[model samples]
Target: MHDAISYLLFLVGTFLAAGVVKGVTGMGLPTVAMGLLGTVMPPASAAAILVIPSFVTNVWQLFYGPSVAQLIRRFWPMMLGIILGTVGGAALLVRVDPVWSGCWLGVALMAYAGYALIAPAFSVPAALERRLSPLVGLITGVVTGATGVFVMPAVPYLGSLNMSREELVQALGLSFTTSTIALAAGLFAHGAFQVSQLGTSAMAIVPALIGMWAGQYVRMRISPKRFRQCFLFFLIALGLELASRPLL
Candidate 1:
């Protein structure tokens, strides 16, 4: 009963954060949700529960936000990299230790969060940005497949690009959607898809959507600096949680 109560609390808090992240930044459901969920559940289960909601939220972003087609066309090479990397990552996940994988993910995310904290300006030259973007996609795709922590690489890349804030948000949204599809397929292939879990995930989507709407509202009131700060703080907390879980 205690464990059950903890699980319920985690689900509620995770979705609430998910919504806020999505609403404010127009992306980050998986990052925020999976991060929080990592504290209470195994990384695999955390990824599982987040999968459906992340997909739904990103789908919503793709439709509601600016010119997704143009963005996709501009980044097809990155998309292909994601596809290839995700397949390879999924294969590795089946063969390795998840705790070790989680540790690496936590370290990477902590580093990314640190970078976000210190960077005063987020601008990359178009030529270098274009060349680096696919590498980010490839790393993110593999990480997404293995640990469900796929937001790191692309977040900085998107931030560095010359797109408007809305466009950056949409790009993250689309990337997550692609990852969710790949993860779902990989999980099913690995026999990790549980009917009961799927049903639970479906039910959780309601609160997740609500939280996203709320987050969008919150985003307008906060400055970008504050948003980045809060985001970094959250990442640190999540990273510590991930690193500590195995020992605890």
Candidate 2:
């Protein structure tokens, strides 16, 4: 049917755009995809579509970095917390109305956009990282499970660690990968992840990969700082748009 074709086209386009953002800025695929797709689909369904692409892309990003073992050893507590929180939050997602989820998603996007605009540069003391990492991880995981957007206190917390650019990117990949996997598991447990959805999610990887390649090419030619500012502004607009949906 025409409607089916149109929906597929939209899915491809959404993932492609999301992939480009991730490739250029090292994050935002799920956030962007969920924000756009949730307009047409349930939040739970949008989250289902994200599982495979997010996992694959983030794993690629994770292995691209050095010292994986060291990072794992350093961040295990946080990882564990993410798992626990996602399991709990996914239960909440299943119980809540989809409209409420959309509203939460909108608020989350707006908050993250506001933070990105401010762009603070700060560092956590070494002692604090050990104490706070799990807490941040738990919060990010709950957000991820409920809204399918996982970059909250976690990203900012990682940024606060004052890592080199490459390390930061790799660390983010690790965190995202963990979140994606946990989210998938949560969805599966809740019976929201149907086999057909898995197939669709797998197919989505191709467009995402293609867009990532294209975005990398663009990244080579432009100032990332400028591009990021533009992207943040766009996200602000998107957040506003999504937020207005329930109100209107």
For all candidates, what are the clash counts? 4, 0
Q: What would the per-residue lDDT of candidate 1 be over residues 7-69, giving only the tens digit for each residue?
A: 777788779878887787666677777767666555667777877888888888766676888
Q: Estimate each model's TM-score.
A: 0.87, 0.97
Q: Relative to the true structure, how large is the alpha-carbon lDDT of every model?
A: 0.75, 0.89
Which ranges of candidate 2 are over 4 A from the true structure? none
Model 1 scores a TM of 0.87
Q: Write one digit per residue (lDDT tens) for candidate 2, span 205-243.
A: 999999899889889999988988888888888878777
Model 1 ranges off by over 4 Å: 1-6, 120-123, 128-131, 222-224, 245-248
The lDDT, on a scale of 0 to 1, for candidate 2 is 0.89
Alpha-carbon deviation at 224 in model 1, angstroms:
5.0
| Candidate 2 Cα RMSD (Å) | 1.0
Query: Could you report the Cα RMSD, in angstroms, for every candidate shown?
Result: 2.5, 1.0
Q: How much lDDT does candidate 1 score? A: 0.75
